[model samples]
Structure formats: C-alpha cells, structure tokens
Target: MDEFEKSSIEGRVIELADSSRREVEQEANEAKAEQQRYIAELLKNSSKTPIVVSAVLTSDHQSIRPDVLQKYLDATILQASSFSQLCEQADLLNVKLIQHGMAENVSQSLDSRGILRLPVIKRHYPSLVYESQAISGELAVIDVISRLNILPIKRFTAKTGTNIGNGEGDGYLQFQLRNMFGGGEQLKLDITKGTKTHSSYLLDYGQPVTPWWMLNSMLFKNSRQFGNNNSIDMLIRGFRTSLRSGFQEAGAINHELFYEAEWRTSKLLSLHASDTLLFQAGDDIKSSLGHTLAVDRRNNPIAPTSGSFLKITNELALGKYWKSQVEFSQNNSWLKDDFIGSCCTFRSGYIANLNSSKKTVNTYDKFHNGGANDIRSFQIMGLGPKDLYDSIGGDAFISYGVSLFSRLPIKKWSHSNFRLHWFFNGGKLINHNNAPLKSVVTQLANQHSTSVGFGILLRHQVARFELNFTLPLTVHSGDAMRKGFQYGIGVSFL
Candidate 1:
C-alpha cells in the first residue's frame, strides 16, 4: 500500500487488463473467422448447381422414373443458359404439358378429400427498355407450387342462346383416370351438336315459302404432314335437310354424304379426290305448285333430287417457272334426272419474279355452266343467264379464259397490283323442244354479254390485319352490271 507498492500494483493491474483485452480480441477474431467460414459454406451449397427434373405423368398418376427425369433435365440443359434458366424452363414445359393434356397429377384420389400439388418456378430478367433507361437493376426469382383439388364427377344440362323456341338442351359429363400412356402424338377430338333452320321468302312479294330443317355433321382433323413436304388428309361428312310447305302435298328430304382424300408429294404436287352421293324424296313440284302458280314457271317441277359427283384434281409445280393445275369433275345428277352435265378444267399459271416487279398469268378451260365455277380471276357479277348457247341440251357449255396480274411495291406495307383478264363464257339452257341455233343466238343476244377489263389492287399487310382495295380501270358493262361500287372488308387467306 506504500508508494512503491502502489505503482507496482497499478503496473500489474494494467498488464492484467491489457492481457485480458488481447485474449478477448483474439477470441472475437476466431469467432468472426468461424462465422465467415459458415457463411461461405452456406453460399457454396446454395451455388452447388441445382438438380432439375421433368416428367410427363400418365393418366393414372405415377411418379416418373429418375432416369426419365434426368433425360428431360439433360434435354433442357442443352437449351438453357444457366441453372436458374433451366428451373424456369422446366416449370414452363410442365405447365405446357398439362395444358396440352399430356400430363396429370394424381396426389389426390377421386374421393375429393386430398389436395394435389405441382411445383412452378419463375425468374425475371431486366427489361430491355428499363435497362436502356438506367433504372433499378434489381431482379427477382420466385418459386412456389400450386395445389389443385379433385372433385366428384357430375352431370349438368343447360340451354344455350342459340337454342330456338324448342326448349332443347345440351348435357355433358367428364371424369379422369390415371396410369395413361405418354410419349406419343397428341390427340384432339371435337364433338359438336346443333341444328339449323333455313327459311326463304320471295323479294317481290314477301311470303313464307319454304322452311327447311337441316342436320349437319362436320368433322375436321389437325393438318399433319408426313415429310417436310408430303401430306395426307382425309375427311368424312354427311348432311340431311328437309323442306316443308303446308300447302304442298308432303315435305321433302335431301341427304348428302361426302368423302374426300388428298395426297401431296414432296415435290409440291397435290392430288385430291372426292366422292359425293345425294338422295332426295319429296312431292313432285310440277303437280303441286307449277300448275297452280304462274310465278313457279322457272321452278323445277318433279325434278329428280338424287345425284352423285366425282372430282379429281392434280396440281403440279412447273419447275421454278410456273404451276399447272388440272381438275375433272363429273355429275350424275342430270343422268339420274334424265339430264346430262359434266365439266373438265385445265388451269395453267406462270409466276415471274423481276428485280422491281412480279407478274403472274393464269389461263383456264372449263366445260359446264360456262366459266362460272372454274374461273380463278375476279368476277364482275354473280348474275349469269340460265342459257347462252344451244350446243348442249341443258344449261351447260364449254368456255376458256385467261388472266394476267402484276405487282409492284410502292412502299413499306403498301403495294399495287394490276390485273388484266379476258373471258369467253357462254352456255345453253334446255327447253321442252330442241331450240334452233338462230333462235338460241337471238335469245343469247338478249340475255348474255361478254367483255374484258382491267383492275388495280392496293394492299397492305404490315399490322395484325391486312387491308385491300380493288378498283376497276375499265368499267365494262359486266363490271358495272351491279348498281353500287364494290367495297369489301376482312383479310383474304389467298
């Protein structure tokens, strides 16, 4: 406790205190190092590259094999840029598979007491515009799984707005099963049920004339090609329609069955064949309406409604220069009805690609109903005389025509096309007695006319929709046959 003793004690105490502080600092440093190591390990594990997997489950939900999942992961890696990308892509593929009816989860049984879960991962990238604007660089990654509940099967019936006054309704029921097969072509089936009614009245004197009930069946399949260019297609259809009139002795029924098959080769040549059979049964109009009404003179009285048709078309590409198509169609309706009608058409066209312009020329030869149904060029009017020639006993004859078209691009999304067409179309109508050539010529002079004209087309196809305007340069009699200028809307698939 003396002065010397007090200094010695203070020195000893200071040394002790410094030594304790050093020890504590060393321990703190060691602890900090250990904490850093732990954090480094955690980061390493998180960055160890995620193991991705994908599976296409069967209808009877079963877990996919590990090897199958690995294969899918490998395939995905080949297309992905990073681990995060791979996870996101897997989720997207799974969603797509489910949407396409390719997979299902069966964690929940049909008892409706359990929940089924599916995993989904989402990633965000810097938006292009935002990045260019130097905005916040923050990005996000979200991972979650959704649970879907299973419910019992139930049936329901409902009436649609399209249902006429008939109180008819539609019913539907669906159920799911597991253990279905995978890894095959996608299948799609469509079933439609509906009814159509057609009624017509005379324009001159409005009156309820005929009410028809039609039962139509239409089936379509997704277009599939075997090779890069070859394709095979098939279709089957049927229709039954009935015409009823209270004043008539009895109603009439018409039935139609059609089948079509097409085979296209790799060389871009397509061959199509179709067969159609029609059957009709009804009261003879001649005895019912023709004798009673003077306005029914142009109507078919006691006409045969049953008929058949066979059509074949061969489309061939003429090298890089042109394309040629030929079609032959025969109708047995006239034969069954004691009249004869048939048609043969030959179409040839050439496409010219110039430095600043393109050109096309098409020619056709048609027999039957003049060039009405066979012509590919624009038609000035839908109205045509019933007869123009006496060569054939019925209203049928042969005609040929040609059309030339050229296009030039005036600006982006805008183009101008010009078409020049000439047609020689004429046909004949049959009467009770054979008509002489002179008389037929006189009738044709009064009822028929022919001409050639040119048309200009303007079109643009830049936006989601396409617009076009067609104007005739030389307005011939047939071109102006209708009263108003022709203006149309909507895009053309052609």
Candidate 2:
C-alpha cells in the first residue's frame, strides 16, 4: 500500500512540473517580444538620417492669420535630424504659439503620424531618404501638420472688497492686453479707489525678455489721505522701470533692479498738524535707482503654515540720499494632528540725507512703524518721536512680532480659511541723530513698545484679515497705542 501511494504522488508531481515549464516558456516569449519592441524604438530614435521638412500645415483659426502661423513655423521647424527630433520641435512650436497668444492649444495632427507610416514610391518622395526594408526604419523628409485653437488676447476684470480691518471699502478695475505686438508683451491698466486711498491710476507694461527675466514699466498717479492721527494727504505721480526675476513663490529667490522718478506733494488735512510735519509738507521731486532681493519659501503668503520669507532693499536717490530695508519672517508647525503653528517676523529700515547740505531726509522716504499691517496695538505711523498729533516719522526703525495659531476645534471648520492666533509684537522707530547704525540698533533694542493680543485670522486669496483684542504690555511716552479690539488688513502681516 505504501508503494502504490508513492507512485501516485510521483505522477502528481510530474503533472505540476509540466505546467510550471509551460508558464516559464510563455513568460520568456513575452519578454523577448518586449525586448524587440524596445530595440526597435531605440533604433528608430538613434538614426542620423537627415530629414527636410517639406511643408507645414496648421488648422484654420480666426484669431491668427495664416501668414503669422507660417512665420512661426518657419522660424522653429527649420531643421530636424530625425522624426523624434521633428516631433520635439513641433511640440516646442506649440509652446511658442501658446506663449505668443496665437493659440492656447496646439497638437500634432493624427495625419502626420499616418504620413510617417505611409508606403510611398520613389516618385512620390523623390528627395526623401528612408530605410523601408529595415524593421526599425526612419523617415527622412515629411510634411508636418498640427491643429491650433485660438484664445482671447485681452481680458477685463473687477475686484471689490470691504476692508474689515480698516473700516473702509476698496475696489479696482483692471484691463489687460496680452501678446501685444505678437511677442508675449502685456499692458495692464488699473483704476482704484478707496476710503483711505482716495484714488490711483496705473498703466503697467511688461515683456518677458527671456524665460528667466521680465522687463516692466509703470506710470502711476496716486492720492492717499491719512485721516487719523497723521491728518495728512499725499499725492504722487511717478514713472518706474524695472527688470525683475519671474514671479514665483515656491522656494525661489527673486530680484529686481529699478529706477523711479516721482513728484510728491504733501498737504496737511488738519489745522492742528504738527510743526515737524508742517515743515515737511511741500512738493518735492525724487529720482532714485534701487535693487530688491527676496526669497520666499512660505507655504502660503497670506497665512503660512510653514517655511520662511526674506527681503532686502537698497536705494540711492538723487545721488545724495540713501535708504536700505530688511524684512524677514518664518513659520513652523510642530503638531501633526492639527494645524497648530507659529510665525515670527522682523523688519528694519534706514534712510539718510547723504547730501551735507540737507539736514533731514524727506518724510516720504522715511520709515514708519506700527499699523494694522505691521506691529499691532499701535496706530498707523504711531511709534517713535511725536510732534503734536502727528507721529513725526523716523529716519530709522526696527520692529518684530511673534504669533501662535491653531485651527478651530470644530471638525467642520478644520478646513476653513479661518484660525485663532495669539500674538506678541514690539518695535521702535527713532532718528539716527548722526549716530552709528549699531548704536541706533542698540537704542532700538533697549527702548521699544510692546503689545500682546489674541486674534481671529481670516485668510483670503487677495489678502489676510485680523481682528485682535490687544493690551499694551510696555508703553513709550507719546506713542499712540490702541488698547482694545483692532481690525487689520493688507497683503503682508506680522
């Protein structure tokens, strides 16, 4: 009985071995077929055959004329070594077309693929060089065809919002012209008006001179009214030209070199305006060249959960006035279960009348500390020396702030663009009095105002809003401090 069982098991084992052998043979055949396909593709792309583009065709589009399309193709598809390279050039041509506003969508036509595979007699393609007998043959000459669809080259947009932080309303109308002169040049016009910003008109032009750089020019006129403690109105008309690195926020550093010429006029809106301000009130002309360098790696510019940002600026005006500013902020999140995080920021600036003939820097060029957009619990332009009701602007200033934030506890509100934040802020602004910059910084560090607050933060695509209930922890005499609920809004926040 044992011998009989052994024979049966041997038979079962033989049958299983046969099945495994067949499976192995099938896989080997499949792999061989795949290898052949890869070799064919490699050979097809490795060919050094010269291919002449016989003709180029594009889909009919109303916005772009046929001659314009032909001109672009003539410039880009002038030469290609192989069909693969031809396809690559064609793809790049599509990109160029889209960039120049000739079309938004450009794709190789299926007919081009068909033509590549078509069997042709020598008479049909007398100048064409092709290896038709080879398993991996390449075509030498071919007509390229593509489909292109047009896109509008102009746009108009309007934006309006209530300034919950400043108790005001603001709105703007924007008009944009794209690809002006068929060269990816753009012109934009903005008309803006607000309660605090009385009115502004801007005409901006930009050209992408290269992939990495942009040239920009702006003509602008602005009128602003400071209604609170400053009680002053300012008007500015300016023209600016700049070469800037492309706008990108994802851990990229950007730079700008600019020249600006402006006419500035200041008028006192209140009869009781300070004598310091009164002396500064008048029309002045300024011409300056400046450079700005910035590094932004923040997850969100409006309300970052992580990463950091930094910016530095320097300017020389009329060759006798100099200014420099540095701003830095960082955000971090330690809790994994919730969006609990902290943000810290520091800002400082210096301006000097390098001209020995002048005694003071222009107020328009000086730096001011404290605002809804800057250090909290203090009025706009509220820090530093005071003359009457005016915060008589400082020639140098430094400010810093820290905040801790968390998402709302409610599960439904976890993904909302709202969070609770507690903050501590402090800063000082002072005239340098011909002192060394290090000594001035030391003075700022020793003598500063501070405030602590808790606030609800609302993040928006256009701006961030904060409503904080604040208390001044340390006060400086003559500083304008806000003691209760304060609403703040603008692009940058501490």
Candidate 3:
C-alpha cells in the first residue's frame, strides 16, 4: 500500500446509516417522557376516583382489650373521597387508637421476667394492615404503628427551695398517675413542708369532660403560720370540686364553677396574741359555691412587659353570706424591646355576713392586706384594724399599685432576668362589722395607707425576689411599717 494509504488511523469510527448515537439517545429520552406522562395521568385519574371507608379494623392488641378498642372505633365516623383521603383518616384514627392502647394499664411486650418478649409495635399491632376496604372501587390499605411498650403512666417529682435572707426553706413532693383507668383520668398527690407553711397535704383527681372543659376534685389540708402581723396559726381542711374551662392560650377567657366545704381553726402562735385574734380563734365550718372568671394576656407572667389581666370571683356561703373580689392589671412597654415597662394594678374584695342572728363573718374568710406582695412597706396583714398587737383582718378592702421597671444599664446585663423596679402602693382595710355595705365602701376609699419604693428584682422560675428600700409616705395609727430595706420572695407580686 502507498505511504498515504498505509498511514495508521489513531481512532476508528463505525456508522450505521439507519441509526446514530444522538438519535438513539433522543429516542430513549422520548420514551421515558411518554412513560412519565402516562404515569402522571394515571395518578391524576386515581386521585379523583371515588372510594368508601365503610369500616376501620384495628389490629389485635394485648394491652387494650378488644371491646374497648371497638368502642373507640365505633365512636369515629369514617368517610373519604379518595384513597389518599382514606389513608389520612386512617392515620388520625390510628393515632387515637395508639393513644388509647397505651393508656391501658396492661403491658403488652413485657414477660414475667420483665424482658421484652416481642417487638413493641408488633405486639400492639399484630397485623401490619390496620384497615382493609372490601367490595368497593379501589380498596385502600392503611398500616398503623402502635407502641406496646411504653413508659409507666405515672411520675414523681420533688421541688425544693430556700430563702436564705429569711432563714426559710420549702419543699414539695408530687406524685401523679395519668389515665389511671384508661379514661383519660388523672390523680395527683402533693405533700408540702416549709417554714411559713408548716405542712400541707392534698389529693386531686381530674378528668376531661370535653375538649375545652375539665372536672376536678380535691381534698386538701394546710397549716400556715402568720408571722408578726397576725402572730397566729391557721389550719384549713377542705374538699372542693370544680369544673374549669381550658385557658390554654394567652388572652383566652377562662371560667371555673366550684363548690367547697371547709373546716377551719385559728389558734394563737404567741402568748401575747391580741384579744380580737383570740376571740376569733376556734373551729368554723363553711360551705360555699363559687365562680371565678379570668382573662389574662401577659407576654410573660413572671415579668410581664405587655398585655392585661383581669379576674372576678364571687361566692355564696351558708345561704346567708356573700363575698366578691375583683383584680386587674395592665402592663405596657414604654421603650423598644424590653428595656423599660410600666404596670398598673387594682384589687378589691368584700364579705358580708347577712345572717340575722350573727353579726361577725368568719375570720378566715375575711380579707387581709399589706405585704411585700401588696403594699411593700407594710407587714403582712398590717394595714387593717388591730386589737393590741395583732391584725384582725377586715370585711372590706381596696388596693392599687403603680410600677415602673427597667433593665440594667450595662450592656452585658441588659438582657438578663434582672430588673430595676420603682413602685407606689396604697390601700385600706375596713372591719365594718355589721356596717352597711355602702358605708364600708366609703371608708375603704377614704381611709388608706400609702408607700413608695425602689428595688432590684430577680425573676426566677419558681418565684420572684426583690431587695427594696421602702418608705411609708402615709400611714394610719395602727398600720405597721417597715422602713428602709425589705426582702420579698413569692410567686405573686404587685
């Protein structure tokens, strides 16, 4: 061969006249596109097709009895427009079913030795398919996952705290059982001990009456020591039942209707207790029906920067007595973010003993005023009438407070849970024994004690603490005063 003809070709090319690589690739892509379009059409048509969800058949479960599961299934109405919709409904039903099963007291996966004998879910859901449609257009199959092994439906918690400034400590232990009988019922027991509250024991039981309502019953016994202001000890044991509306969100209005029966005893803690306090000491029984309505919208309850709160309560006791109380507070932020804020609060209460034979109301049922929680410069229950050295409480009272709050100036501490607080408080407490209601109200408005203070405030999870320098601006003869620095710690404050 000639040199030109013999020159080696580095690459070889094979070409078919009927087909090329580009054409082949384009054909393959077109086939894939057609297949996808067909699939899309099928899915669209299937989604619009009618389907019937005639029944929901849950798998066998050992923890929840068959009859109980059946009742839950029967209560639910099943309807669906398409297979996908049917699946959605089945999912919701499955969730409820699992919850009901888990609430049962029986253990499904545990054996005698406490070892897992089977898969938790498999034990609860014996069959993978929860519901199967029959004799209809396209049948839908839904699988529900159920957990047979669950944590015990009970819990125990302990809370402890101390106020080193006051040399006081408190602790609480609570035990709760959830769904005790598999009907969404709960039982709780609380035991408390502290320096101020000598001791307390309570048993509470509650159950959901509706999605937005609950029924609760409680038995409680408490012993509390009133310090210098009263120098008395009080014991109250009571049984109360109430129906409460769920106020799960801010700004929601809530109502509570309750009936309470209490046995109360007042005893002197000091040998020099006042004659009025001694006269009020003894056993008393009260039966009352009451209602409480509240609307709260605070952004943060611990240290509110915005919104308002209002609560009104009324009680009727012994077919002869009437008591009413109202409380309100409004808070607003004056500067951007949480740098500064202001709050206004008002509280008033009245008790009337309408018995034609009796002139005095129960001491424990009367209103007591003056405290770090209320008027900062006064001792607890100190602003009311006093017999010798003890505050005898009052039949009618009115209190109001105005407060300004700001964050620390340092950049590093500006966002901390510490606040500078300035406040003005004023109130009056009237005994008004056998006095007309109108006269008592007039006295409550005309005679009062006033105080002003500034303090450092610390907001804690369980309580708010304050170190304040308080000055009594105005005071009556019997109103106890605490000038200069005062320390306070409590869950509620004005």
Best by lDDT: 2
Q: After best superposition, candidate 2 residue 225: deviation in angstroms?
A: 3.2
Across residues 1-494, which tens digit of lDDT does each residue of candidate 2 receive? 89999999999999999999999999999999999999778648644434456555544455555555566666555445455555666766776666655455666642343234434342233344447855433344444444544454443344544433455577777777766665557788888888788899999998666544678999999998763453789999999999987544267789999999999899988877777767878888889999999999987777678889999999999755788999999989876644898989999888876874665676667788877778888887778887766666787888899999998888999879898989999888988766787888788778689999998988898888888999999998888888898998778887
Model 2: lowest-lDDT 10 consecutive positions: 118-127
* Winner by lDDT between candidate 3 and candidate 2: 2
lDDT of 3 by residue, 187-252 (tens): 788888888888999999887654356789999999987645437889999999999886444578
Off by over 4 Å in 3: 1-154, 158-169, 179-184, 227-233, 248-250, 267-271
- TM for every model, in the order presented, reads 0.22, 0.69, 0.67
Q: RMSD per prediction, one decimal?
A: 29.1, 12.8, 15.5
Superposition error at 92 for model 3 (Å): 17
Give me the runs in candidate 2 sitting further than 4 Å from their true place.
Answer: 1-154, 158-164, 227-231, 247-251, 268-270
Q: Write the per-residue lDDT of candidate 1 for residues 1-494, one digit (tens) a residue.
A: 59999999999999999999999999999999999999778646544232222222223323333443334335443244334444455554454334323345212111122332222223223222443665543332222222222121111222323322112222222222221233211222233332211111111101111111112222232222211112222121222122222221122222222222222111112332111100111111110111001111112222211222222222222321222222222222243222222222232221221211331111111122211222222232222322121111122222233323333224432232221122222222222122454554454444333323333333233211212222322222322222212222222111
Candidate 3 to truth, TM: 0.67
In terms of lDDT, which candidate is stronger, 1 or 2? 2
Clashing pairs in 1: 59-178, 59-179, 59-180, 60-178, 60-179, 334-339, 388-427, 389-427
What's the lDDT for all of these models? 0.28, 0.75, 0.72
TM-score of 1: 0.22
